[model samples]
Target: MDLILDFFLVSGIVIIAIILLQLFKVKHKELPQKVLIVLFLLLFFVAIHFYALLHNIIWLIHLCFLPNDITTTILGPLLFLYVKTLFLKEDGLVKNTLGHFIPAFLFALGITIPTMLFNIFKIDTLAYTHTNFIRTIIRFESLYFTLYLFISLQLLSRYRKLSKQKYSNLTQYDFNWIKIMFLSALFIMSIDIGIKLYESFWGDLSWNADYISVLCMIVLVSFLGYYGVNQSKVLLPSFLLNKEKALNIEKTKDKTLSPNKKEEFETLKHKLEQVLHTDRPYLDEDLTLGKLAQQVSTKDKILSTLLNQYLNTTFYDLINKYRVDAVKEKINLDSYKNYSLFGIACECGFKSRTSFNRIFKKHTGFSPSEFKNNTL
Candidate 1:
């Protein structure tokens, strides 16, 4: 058990250190990246705290410089902010959200600082550390973690929905990594809370279950390091920020369009189809609703409303539908017979084979190869 715990502790420390170095080397850091760096730094301190505790390093533990408890308070806020900064395109987002860190700040001031001062004065801090008040505070921290994690997951879901509306290719903007991270954190938090509750009622178990949580943390850290390093900033458009307005628009979709408005949308839809069929703008792998709107000579919001209300489709579905049709057309051609399935998919503006297969199957109920075979 000791051997396994040592391995996890070392692995977690090394993973966090490597990620920190990588983040530090970034030439230009955005708000999300900066938040991510701080997030990992706190994780590093967490790793060190566990190491110190496990090794019985009295001085290191007593120093309270790392303040693992404070990190528990801070991490939740940092995670929510990371998701927010990734999706929201607002000025001074980090600065404006400084209030979120107040709990962590107060924790450091009330608990960690006093502990450090006691250690400096060679005072016994056992009375303060082992109190019922501290235990209650720890429980509250667990609740705090739960609340922020829930909020982050909710925000991620909304962002994903909005992304599908605006961007055709969701490869870069998917934020699946963030979802995985939060889910993993949720798993770890559940384990920790369960164990704590068990200990509160039944006293400590013979074996340490914390080692399991620590091992999971190591794996989670490695996962975050790999994906976080490659993650691009997801700056949502200004219109997307107003989610209330978007919701109102969705609510009004059932309302009948005025005849003039219906005619206007009909003309716009005709022009949109003409441009898509003639110009083949969907063939751009990075095509977006705004780009397609420019090609169709209409505002993106109008184009969006046209697709949503009149066509009974989304921008993503409409664009991908054309691409799939183009693929089917190419597949049926004699000259394109020698082209590989992936080759045909790429030529039809499908960015990746996985997306192509998934989208093709979604639309035609057959994989790309199956479709080609049946048609041929």
Candidate 2:
């Protein structure tokens, strides 16, 4: 058990050091990167706190203990803010999110500082007085962190749904890594809470259950550092960012098209189809609803409505359908017979082989290679 804890402590230090070094080398760090740097710094302190505890380093434990306790509040909010920064392009991100850290600040100022000062000055009276109250507050830390994790997951779900409407290729915008990390954190937190509950009711277990939670935390921090470095800004449009408006637009019930409106829809739809067939705009690979709307000489909202209500499909599905058809046509042609499946998919605006194979299977109920072989 001691060896395992030592391994985790050393691994945490090494991973955080590497991440911080890479982040510091960046000339101009974005908000997400800045948040990650702060988050990892806190995790580094956490690693030190555990290491100090393990080795019975009295001074080091005294130094890190209170700060580590405070970080339980701050770390969750930092991760929530990181997800927010990635999805939303807003001014004054730091200024606006200052409120999220107030709990941590108050805990530090009211609880941590006073407690630390009491210990340092050997003020037995004050330390004894605040002991129970401090324990009560610390008991709620897991719940607080769990709430932030839930909120982060909610924000990620909303942004992912909206992203499918705006962009055809969601490879960069899908924050799946963040989702997995949050879910894993929640799972680990649940186990830790359960262990604590058992310890409270029954006598202390032989083995240290905290080792499980701390080791999992170190692993999670390493996971976040790996993906968080490469994460790109989503840059959703103003329309998609307005939650009330977007919800209303997406959830509105379909109604029968009026004669004049139907005529207008038909005219725009005809033009849209003509342009798609002739111009082959879906071949851009980075095609978006707004760009397609521009080619059809219609507003994006109108195009979105046409696709959603009139056509009964999403912009993503429609675009992929066209690309799939194009690939099928090319596969049937004698001249293109020698082209690799992925090579053909690339020419048809599919970004990668994985996506191409998945989408091709979805559309035609056959893998790309299977479809090509059957065609031959």
Candidate 3:
């Protein structure tokens, strides 16, 4: 038994040590608050469970006095925080102050109060004495565990809802690893709580071993490093949202168009250039393939094909290139020098200062004002 406990115990500690080292690697990167929270929960679990391993070594008893309820109480809420941190937009609902921690605080207090009270009065019964206070604590443990389950369910449902809606602006979030970590922890905690509840009712400690809990703790601690090592944090840009991207390759793909359709496409493309040079497409943020296709008397598929093959860019980029060109021309004009660069971009059909600046910088490597100043 000691040999088994020692093997699992050392393995758990080594895994956590690796995770701690991995955190330093991504210290410069943007870590969402929920990821940070998961990191701390893992650290806490390791610290307590490591002590359990120490106690097992010294006392020749597995699981020592370090109860499973400590980590079992925390797994769900930490996962709930993870969901909020990943997919939420600006100033989301999860951004409350310390009040949000009341549930966790109360649970921690439940554990501390019992142990502290036991120590203060030398009430050996929580360990040796079978008392009402211990029973009450177990009951509250079940209630909080249930609350955590419900919260996790809500987070999962909300994640599905937001993902299905396909919000174009916030597609950058990819919490796939964190999602797996949360689910795994949730599974372990559910079983841990079930055991606690059964023990509280029947006074049987079936399947409650310190070694098993310690093994799971090691796996949970690896969550921080696992995602960082395997994945990238590059966010999805606004232009790529819900839009099919053109494949990049040396060989041109077969267009599958007939002789009559080919002539019609060339004619329409020429007319589109003429109309766009006259009126411009950059002025409208909602300018899409369908809209462009209609103005030129062609279908969306034909226009999309042209944009994909000839331009070697998405429809969004193709339009933005023209917008940038127009912005530069306006900036060069001496008459427009009297107005702000933003005003110049507005006249060139840019809807917002931010869009104008972003698209211009993407192409020109300079902001609108910066480019204007340099040209002037």
Q: In candidate 2, which residue pairs get closer than 3 Å at backbone N, Cα or C atoms, i.e. clash?
A: none
Which is the better candidate, 1 or 2, if ranked by lDDT? 2
Backbone clashes in model 1: 0
Give the alpha carbon lDDT tens digit for every residue of 97-200 in model 1.
Answer: 89999988988887767766765675675348557777667667766887899988998998887777788888777688789889879988888888888888
Indicate whether candidate 1 or candidate 3 has the larger lDDT: 1
lDDT per residue as tens, model 2, 1-376 = 6997898799898989999999988898988888888888888888898899889897987888776868878988888889888877768877888999999999888777777778678777657526655665766787789899999899889888777777888876757888999999999989877776676677568876767877899999889988888688887677766654454554333355677887888899899999999999999999999999999988888887777657767788889999999999998687877888888998999897887899899999999889988988
CA error at residue 90 for candidate 1, angstroms? 5.1
Give the Cα lDDT of each candidate: 0.80, 0.83, 0.57
Query: Which whole-number lDDT from 0 to 100 does residue 149 have in model 2?
Result: 94
RMSD of each: 2.3, 2.5, 15.5
Q: How many backbone overlaps does candidate 3 show?
A: 1
Best by lDDT: 2
Model 3, runs deviating above 4 Å = 29-70, 89-97, 120-130, 139-143, 160-174, 206-210, 228-376
> In terms of TM-score, which candidate is strongest?
1
Candidate 3 local lDDT, residue 80: 59
RMSD of 1: 2.3
- Expressed as tens digits, the lDDT of each residue in 173-221 for candidate 3 is 3455555765675676676677766766888664434445556757766
